[model samples]
Target: MISHSSTAHPMPNSVVNLYVYDQSIAGVAKMPLDDFATAFGVPKESINLNSPELRRYFLNHIQIITEAKPWQTHIESVRVINSNDPIVREYQELLLNFICTPVKRTSTRDFTFKYDAIIHQVITHKIMVNVVQDWQGGILGSQVQVGEIALNIPKGQYFPLVVKLQNGSWWKGFGSMVSLGMYHIAEGADHLLFLLVLLLPCMLVPNGQNWGAFASASFGIKHMVKLVTAFTLGHSITLFVGAFQWIRLPQQWVEVWIALSIMISSIHAYRPLFAKKEGWIALGFGFVHGMAFASILMDIRLSAGALAWSILGFNLGIECMQILLLTVVLPLILWLSKRSEYILFRKVVSAISFLIACFWMLERIFFFKQL
Candidate 1:
């Protein structure tokens, strides 16, 4: 089987995957085992499935032609995968990763595939071709069949299969990223909890060692705007830089820090921890949260232009969600600030946020350790 997708490399290329059955593919390359073992021995539990010879064989057989020129093909990696049938039995498949680069930069969208790897020698074998990811075409995390490559029994020849993908545009990819960012924040309960908990005490002043009376609405609004803006600025910086890989952090540590940020905000909500300096604190923690956001972008394959658009779109989506949340909750929070029971309510919420953050931190720590 063969599949195509856009690559994550800086240079534009098409990522093609070739899946060959282990038993069937053994005929294409020499085995490390002896001749007797290769001919009569039972299958070992583990063995090397790919080699230089096999890679060269693949490069010689598979060709992607576009604009009437053959695209350069190279083997990226090879690995064994368990593709067992739940109802039937267990078996393994060899997955060969191929990187096909266009001779001209403008011809990445359409191509003709000419693959004769195992099929060249094993006429009975057929290759299924599919499109697994096409960002511009709005295909992500799903497979759509293109066509198959097989020998014409009557003609006794293999025909080249021309793949015509849906024309992709920059706007479609950018819009999808925006939706992705919005969904990410909407689902990330911990991120929302951190921001909300920090906002809880915005309307209250710090008098002596405790939270004082309700501050004026204008004062609260000014403070909130500063805090939120500081946060946005913080995350945006790291989001841009981190996505480009200028700075990198371990995902587990980022998660741990995010949980820690929530805990700090929750404690500050309960009492005056950093009272008037909440904006700075938000900015600092925002950097940590931004690191977590960058992790999402790192998984996607994009050219430089696509990456830039994705970052902008994703950040806009995040801001939109944050504004929507604040719109719904800000007035309610302000109203509650004037009530006598507001102090108790704040403590309850603060306590809950702190506990939730603690749970998240521990869960991430233990989970990562196990891995």
Candidate 2:
């Protein structure tokens, strides 16, 4: 007999790969074949040559594979299907049949035990919950969707279903907004640092009677508020526009300009660079910050109305956090100004800010590649 050894080898324990696509956008996930069959209510034997459902499944698989692996365009579909040999196919079929066989209704005790087991698997194991959270953030940017937006669900969707639950309310939405605000502040270290440096100068003025101190504090507060507000307004406008496909700004230029703006502000802290026209300077630089903020929204492709709400919520969150920081820091800053160490502290903080700014400027301008 002709040797078949050249064409076939002993199969591994499993052969199927299940790819889950993002409901909002067609992305792919590679999963076990047995799991895929259970998820779709398809039989492994039916996945062979003749079944229409099998053919449909194969087509979906091919579509995702084509999108993800563009270079593999020349690969034949029949060849791809047949690549899993007899032993592999048998193993996959066995696993799928075992998992998908429906159980008969049992006693309440059995049901409770099973329910507890499922909860343990879901909550303690946590793989399912984490995957779902990541998928939701990819779509919603942590916003809680309600009403008709929640009804348009797709098959194999991975987002948290809680947002659509009857118990889900505005409190959840507010909490989500708060979480996103803190996340943005933590993630945008450069922005936070620039704001801190801006506050450093105010720390040097005398607390009560010093007219220069009073003037500087008043100016700083007004300038910071105007700058932040302008940034919020600019970004909100662009975010909606970009998300809805109205306009597209060059992202690379946006990032570079954002870094440059921070650098410029840091330099200004060293000496009064925009002393008289601080508001104008803030407005000009705030435009760049707006672009930076817009970049985040563009990454989240939501429906037009959803995008608008997200932009509003995100900006409101940012403003609230900024206000909170000011409330806590302003009193301490006013008190510190009257101290003997105030001038030294300002110089040291300003020097550090200037150094960081120079580093960022060089990194952005020359494409330093490594920070």
Candidate 3:
């Protein structure tokens, strides 16, 4: 299989990934003691994987053309990787990475790809071509089929594939990031749990140590708004700094802290540990949660201009989702606060949240120790 992709600040060149089964390449085999072993008409040991002849062979067989001119191609590296598929279980494949550059600066979206590789000698072999990532095309983290390359049995020749990818714009990329952010929060249980636990007692007044009667609707709404804004502000600061790599912490520790934050909030919800100062506590925990959010942006690896847009879109999505959730749940919580049994209901929810957080904390610690 051959994959065409691009990343941040993509140059006027193309990156390709070529996957070939070991059995298709003669003399090269997967052995028990070696990742890639060579057999010259008989069983033998390893050979130089970085041989010039091997590189030349691949470069000669593959071609990427735009207009009437051919691009300069280089074999970056060849790696042996094991397969876990049921059909080819325990088998190994060779990954040949290639970088092709045009003689003159031009767009790489449209090109004619001609690859033979092992299929030149192995008649039954086939090669699949796909576009795995085109950042500008809004094709991040996905695979789209370009075409396949195989011998035309009757004609005894291989057909060249012409690939034309869809055009993309900045809005498309930004919109995708927004959707990703909304999905992340909607799917993240820990983030939702912490927010919900913190908001549990916002509608009630503090009576020295315990939660008192339900406050006026206006007061409750105002307090909730202040608390949510503080949390949002705290995270937004770290999300920006951490995305640019200005501040970073070990992911394991961040995860452990996130779980711990939920546990602490659960305690505060049940007994009003922080009482009227919940907004301050929310701000502190929000900073920790922002670090976790930063890991996502770091993995995206976008360029400066695109990264800025993404950060804005992503944070907007998170806030929108949080507002939506609060809108749906706020009325119910307010009504329950006036009931005589709301204290019991609140304690039950807090206990469950605390136990769930304890489990997550222990799991994250175990993962950290293993690393």
Candidate 4:
């Protein structure tokens, strides 16, 4: 039984459902009553899920169901059953209803009253609470431990804790937040393609219709820095607002637009569309990308001080990754821009990137499930 002097609570009150299972002490073992009394001197279920000062009585039991014992009896009654038949429905219910035990209890010491203040804020909708019990083959102890848990969330299981956000200091999980940003940016193929394709032409001078070597490396570097900074600023704005729940956008639309951005830039490599205004394009399309980034944080339900720190960490990670990628690729692009063969490599890569962007655009629009 749970001790009254115990300081730790089993679980936080945010938990919507609680499950209690009673294990068989004997389990069909040839053991004496004294041994059972000594092993489990006090029944763990005696305290129940709440206070233990109640006079209400509860039963500890298990039921067995087998194909020969149940199906044989149920199958014998069926004769030319149809979809709409009453007997068919009854038989179906019996077959599906494998619940061996039902929970029925009433007590004056209401445990839920502890969360009455915040329950309305969290549980905005009705939830059906069903009870079930099962039998085990081995010796079961008096202690209870949490088993498997399945959450209806994407990426990971986010525990919804009922925290006093007004007074409590936010958790410092900067590394985790940074990792989230790095992983997302790395996996965002369309986003990276759009940025890289635009950057490829940064060093080359646009002469009316054709591309040639830069006037100076400094000039190329200057423009590159400006474009990257602009892109960073554009996304930062929406990421903050979206995390705070001040704005929202559909994910599918954002992904489709992102793919479209990549396609346009890839096409521009073959034919100059934006020319010297790549910075402007990066800033403009960046808002859409920022919204996509915000959706990740919002889905996990981050807020306030924690939200602030996480955003900082995430953005910092993005910048670090961006810088790292540019450091490696920018020099290579500059070296190759002066070569005659580089143009061939550029066009080939651009064509492949455009095709990939096309595929992504179609997939996002059609809601194709990627395996």
Candidate 5:
């Protein structure tokens, strides 16, 4: 039976006593009480083995110590023999095993392997950490995480990564830009419809003497090129300024204005609203499109040079797609114009465009809550 030391003084607030037992050793080889006392620099009389408080403190603070020969099969169990509380025991377990472990050295020979390993680990850990945070309501609640993971990565590194992943080459950025331009044209139904409506009037003029067709088609292409160019320049300027200066506009207001611009453009198509100064209308409206484009660039958070490259890439893509569409649609427009049902088709297209624009305007302005 364990005997209590009556002469034991109360343990100091800053000091904690613990027992490290080597379980692998046979009988009598367990922690020698004299050595434990000597190692801890405490008097033999201070050890109250039977005292529950002292026993708990010891259990929570200390881990069982063991030794094994190199390459020998050994089972080493680390037991927190005493602690102030259960939390202390857990803290000791975590600190002793994980926190106190030495960091592995990175060798020059295995730099690439280690670098990839580290990257994989970081990405995996980030994903897992986010998942855990979400589970704990740390992510899904009021807090939002932001900022780049690699603050040290150079702008040069960033451009290469963007180009490598996107275009497969830095110089082939133009090809990527063209592809993006085509995608934007194909995806932008409203923009395409607006152009289509403008094409309608061109389809009505009689064959050979189709002055309206020739003029409108040529003017439409010129206007589109000018308008898109103005838009690209305007947005590129603003995108760089806004991104670097950290200028942000209310997203809702921006979206509302964009929808409004489209609605107005659609209305112009219904009648000769912008008639003689159609290019001016396109140019003016293109400014609004510029802001929309800037918002896209801003979302990307690219560096100034890369952002410039992206602007070129994106605009080129838009231009290439527009040109392709015009090429394909021009002959179709010419052929359709000669047909008896051309006017009917034109009116129908214009009406659908107008209705869609109106719907968008309403959705953007009033259905803000739904979005």
Candidate 6:
């Protein structure tokens, strides 16, 4: 993952996610009592927009900012998110304990039920009126910058993204993440190298110590399809499940396995490792690669609907690129495999992959020390 902090140049990624859920009802977001003492009317002294107390009041008063669709329901159960990080776990625990329990407040109005939770309702998105500041520290656009974007993001943690959903669109957010997924997959040299090395031998068979004549076009196409299919199936399973938080695997372990898979597959090109069962190897190792793919999703927590869209968009982007690359490269490999010199070429390619994969494994081991 590229950290926004490590480089001097800022690579700003506007990614806002659903982490905290407000547990309340009636769609009436509470304002700080100090700002407006009356529920129905604004007070005289608190009428000043410059007042610090009124500022906090208005910040909470921005309601239903998200343009909600008619079909979308807000009936989700308000529960704490599960996390291994102590800060996040404790934050969830505290939020749940504070918000879930009912609170009965006596009201003069003919209201039957009291407010259970002080916080706002849990939903897909929150609306906020943008609060910008003036050059002289006066509020502009009635907005405030909530958090600082310090350059250094700690490893093994998500880089902090501070975005105000003042006027942001849903599809735009989805598109940004999809673009990110495409970029990551495109830059994965080890993964591409692994695929390349494994692909070369698919068109040839073993003749004594060297590769035999090229397989028929049908055989080669079928062979490549099988490997690709198995790989896709294996990775997609882990990618979807991991993204949805069904199972969690240590990233370091997954990267280690990915590098190992590449090296082993490279050797298999020289001399068969799994023979006709190479699909099984692809399937197994593809799980590791998929887990690596799932890492981006682990960082940003989105509402269920948004998350579904994200998964669909990102996978579409990844698979499309993968297919495009294969479409262009496979024919060239098929052409080369027809020549007598292809066996040596295959050997040379595999050798390069083997060395690169070894280096990747070492790099993965010392991950904490790297950018």
In model 4, what are the clashing residue pairs, if there are any? none
Number of clashing pairs per prediction, in order: 0, 2, 0, 0, 14, 6
By lDDT, rank the candidates, best first. 1, 3, 6, 4, 2, 5
Q: Each model's TM-score, in the order given?
A: 0.76, 0.53, 0.74, 0.56, 0.47, 0.58
Most accurate candidate by lDDT:
1
1-371 per-residue lDDT for model 5 (tens digits): 11123513232111111110111110001222333444444565575555554434333322222121111111122223333332222211111111111123211110100011112222221100001011111111112222112213345221101100111233443444445546656886755765555444533333332223334556545554555455445545554555454576765676666666666655555455655555565555555555555565454333366456666776666656666777888778666756667656665766777788778778777876521
Which of the two candidates, 3 or 6, achieves a greater lDDT against the reference? Answer: 3
lDDT for model 6: 0.55
Q: Which scores better on TM-score, 3 or 6?
A: 3
Q: Give one digit per residue, the lDDT tens place, for model 4 in 225-344.
A: 988888899899888988888987777787788898889888887667888887888787778788888877664433376567778878887888788889988888778877888778
Candidate 5 stretches greater than 4 Å from native: 1-181, 202-248, 338-340, 368-371
lDDT of 6 by residue, 98-156 (tens): 11111432211111121212122211111221223111122211334343222232442
lDDT of 1 by residue, 130-167 (tens): 66556676554455667777778999988887877767
Quote model 4's TM-score. 0.56
Q: Report how far residue 207 has shifted in candidate 2, in Å.
A: 19
Better of 1 and 2 by lDDT: 1
Q: Give the alpha carbon lDDT tens digit for every residue of 139-250 in model 2.
A: 2342222211111235522222221222323344344545665578668877677667656554332333321343455655665566556655655565556656567677
**lDDT of the candidates, in the order given:** 0.73, 0.45, 0.72, 0.52, 0.41, 0.55
> What's every prediction's RMSD, in angstroms?
8.2, 14.8, 8.3, 18.6, 22.0, 14.9
